[model samples]
Target: MQYLFRLSAIYVRHRRLALAFFCLLQAQAAVAGDLFHTDNADLYSRAFAVVPAAISGDTQLKFGDTPPNLRLRNSLIIGTGAALVAVYGSNNWWQSGFGGGFDTTNEGWFGSGTKFGGADKLGHAYINYAGVRLLTPLFESAGNNRDDSLSLALWSSLGIYTAVEVVDGFSHNWKFSPQDAIANVSGAVLGVALETHPGLDAMFDFRIDYRRSPRSPKFDPFGDYSAQKYLFVVKADGFASLRENSFLRYFEIAAGYGTGGYDTGGNHQRSTYAGLSLNLSRLLADDAYGGHMHATAFQRGTDRLFDLVQFPTIGYARRSLD
Candidate 1:
């Protein structure tokens, strides 16, 4: 975690590294699957998945849902891995000029000195982190116990990224960076750890916030570092005691890092922030959801959405590090 914080101190220059990272926010709805047993889209999707189901049929999931046993031969697990490899190869790599004989690039520095302001390292981490969280539930939903699911997610996430790096080692446009590997490993481990432990999962979230860069002629959430903020948060609702504290429940501690002006010409700026962050999802999920606010399906989606993306909220203590 300390290493993660240190590396995060340098994300003002984040740009898109994978199409997967670009899809992560939307991936929540697809990947979370039957974990929450939510209604509407979730229910419809669940039914569609079972019309000729590869494994199981519709079922309600409880917060206390227990895993039965591990299932190694699962279609979802294998399909997800193959999809990642195929999408990565086709989207960012394996293109015309993107291929070449083995080569390397000495990418380094977690500051302004590195390519793309070293913020792309966070991109590496974010991809793997999102990968683990997205896949763990799929594994468990396929009948693997939590421990087995987490373990598979960790290894699969690492393997997928490592494979991408190996391809980059032979690519024409990019090179494999030890820095990226470090970030990838850090994210995979952290993802599994948080999923393995509920207390930690509730307390902290590694999330990225983004808006299209004004300099860009079109909206580009993937490559716009000027408007991207990577946030590490500790929510007050993590504690049962704090959860009962009405006023304190929606407040949280947020530490964030990002680069600005990178999207604008050469006028680069780096910033880091720490202070109170409002948990708007919690506000919507708990106190403000009419009366059926006890883990309703809407609350499930909101919680997952907030976990993956840091929605805009009023805050204080933001400061420029550069």
Candidate 2:
């Protein structure tokens, strides 16, 4: 019991680090599935380029707050791994007659469809929220500038969305949903807008809407033919940091709104789902060689444990000390 309490306290202290690390790692590993395919590399590259330029206003790339890493190799490993996972999992789901498709809505991010419906599939939006929260923190840690983080988030989101589209583009069960990709990028950009542009704070936030329709090509061929009505959720979330001095480590919080319900043709019915989006991530270590390590462990104990146990095991011993 003592150990449990100690662990709890430890986690409390390092919660931000744990959360950030885990989320970034998850985003790095899981979210890239739809971002890396070659079907439209040129278009994607251009789309990705537009985001950084638009968001940052400078030509510099937003590669996280961390320094120096090979772009191509890093993107490939993250992208390919995510794509394969999506494909493998997608195939498994398709066998059960679950072919994913795009939403048809103008209200989404940049006017794209990304909703998925059908009663049993309500939890998919949760997966997307997890990804966004995890990825968003990667941008929050910078001293003040979030444009880079926002740009990186959108770029990564687009990369994953594209990869999924590419895989679907070739598959027999689903066609590439470029519109969905647009929605994703737009949603990510919206997230950035909320963070960077204070004016949007009152009007915008993180949102997820899922729909399953019989008339839509992506779902009609499967099996059930009823005009299936599912759920639509909207959330307004943000992340901020608290600094005491240059020495005391950084603190952060991510908060948002979530709402959903069944949308039966004529009018979209709804449900109330309000929650907070909170996460705390900090830099674990910075090296003289332009290299650094970071983690998002959510509690002080876990954060410390990561520093003590995981650090030595991974040759990042210095992070533990930091």
Candidate 3:
């Protein structure tokens, strides 16, 4: 009874921000392509048509009398690591062995190691930015409130960047970048700012390139295959929080895909996918504390359509502000 009440209070407190965030994401996602192909009105028209339906669906799912509950059983689950302890506990270990001391000496992008120069730094930033944008819901729970969500965004981005830096700093093969870490946090905050602020919303479109071959084949996994395809994809993806009731997690999924093909397909393909995701935290226990499974079917140029299942790990929190 006490636990249920506490959860309810959390949900009610952060309800508006959570929903606003979700709706803004859906709206942004629906029209994301417009920012790229400023010339294509028809493509954007179709995307705009889907926004109301998406918002309506979100509302109905929440208002439904019986909510979905597919969380993993108790025996399978364990709570997250003790928050404060995790930060302090791992400090000494990282500093001593990982050469974790900050370097005021190494300056500029890729200055410590390989130099594709600025492009390499940009490519790495893209992934970190995308990762943060996609994983917002898990860390920014409505149950915690708006300030919590914002805090989560800032801290989680920092934490992830720090963890990655620590690993790279200590690893025998790689050099750590305080610069890369700064870029990631900057991009994440920029992404969140784009979503929340009206005047700057349109500034969300930016591309970072990942080079092949002469750039660094060893680190590039796509180099394994004989086919080297340059894919130009316009993607808008997000996770939304379901209302707190009987369910653990629920999110609407939608994506528009336009890839410049290298083959005989006239160098283009237009695709759209829509589906629902189920959070599987209760099932997997360890791997899925706040994780989810996305099931989507995509249509590609008449006959080339397919379905996919992606289970993304829940993002770690950026804040310790309990």
Candidate 4:
């Protein structure tokens, strides 16, 4: 009974925070107007028009048939509340790494000698950032406005991830990592900011690529730190000026970091890299490839996929920083 009550309380508290902040964002959004395309009369402004917002980098928004007779406040409350419930379940997920009591550990950040060579930190960030983007679509599909959906995604992500850290504070194997907390905040903020400003979102993508080392120990895919790389990608297609340049539109620039020989292998080293990369998303959306004036579902999927996973075959490594 006590355990159930505690679990219930967790959801209740976070829901309150979700509601409070969502209400505040609702006000701000009212002033800001529609978040995606500036002009509703634009071709893509129609519901799920399957058209990308030119070079602005706004993803396909499902501007739903939410009835105008319905008050925006009530719609927002119902929509955001449903999303929070789905993401923030009423259960104590803290049973893992079950420590009898509270504990602590000092895990340094990004040092060659540190655990997994800071891969876990980047992992934390990536998951949070991805979570926000992924969750926003659910609200959008449910007829929630872009502003409410995005704000809910942001607040729910932080509240849920932070709750995990708090639970770690009480566990035995893992102590709460302040560094992980900071990364969570950073990623969540980046996700919301990019969604807000499509131009900036156009120029950058945070991604992970994996190429297993020959000597790597056979650990689980995620724990196989030797095989993972984190990247930031800048796409030329994001610039309207480059769109007409047949060759340059698909060009990209990438920089990334990785670690080798860790996770039970010998001789660990940190690797940094720079490279020329292809914009697979733009390639699919191009007219020469039977694409249209705007992005299609297939093209949109490619863009979202590349946001997290970098396809190594399409990218060229210029040099490495050992």
> What does candidate 2 score in Cα RMSD to the true structure?
19.5
Cα deviation at 258, candidate 4, in Å, is 0.9
- List the candidate 4 regions with Cα displacement exceeding 4 Å: 1-97, 212-221, 287-294, 316-322
Per-model clash counts, in order, read: 2, 44, 5, 2
Model 4, range 1-322, lDDT digits (tens) per residue?
9999999877666664454344334433432234332233432335343543363434433345443222343335434544453333222222232436656567888987787788878877876787677767655654557886787677656765665565566644467788888888888988888888888878788887877666654533444677788788888877889867989988888888877767655777787878777887777666455745235555555568877688864554534334
Ordered list by lDDT, greatest first? 1, 4, 2, 3
Total backbone clashes of model 2?
44
Task: Give the distance in Å from residue 148's predicted Cα in candidate 3 to where it truly belongs.
Answer: 1.7
Residue-wise C-alpha lDDT for candidate 1, range 105-222, written one tens digit per residue: 7787557766667567787788789878877776766766676567667766776677667667755667778888899999898898788788898899998888777686666555
Which scores higher on lDDT, 2 or 3?
2
User: Against the true structure, candidate 3 has what lDDT?
Assistant: 0.34
For model 4, which pairs clash? 52-295, 99-172
- How far is 295's C-alpha from truth in model 1 (Å)? 3.1
lDDT per residue for candidate 3 within 214-272, as digits (tens), equals: 32335442221111211222112221223333343333232222112222223223222
* lDDT digits (tens) for residues 51-138 of candidate 2: 3324444645465433222243345544554655454434442333222443322323211122322222222222333344444444
C-alpha lDDT (0 to 100) for residue 322 of candidate 3: 12
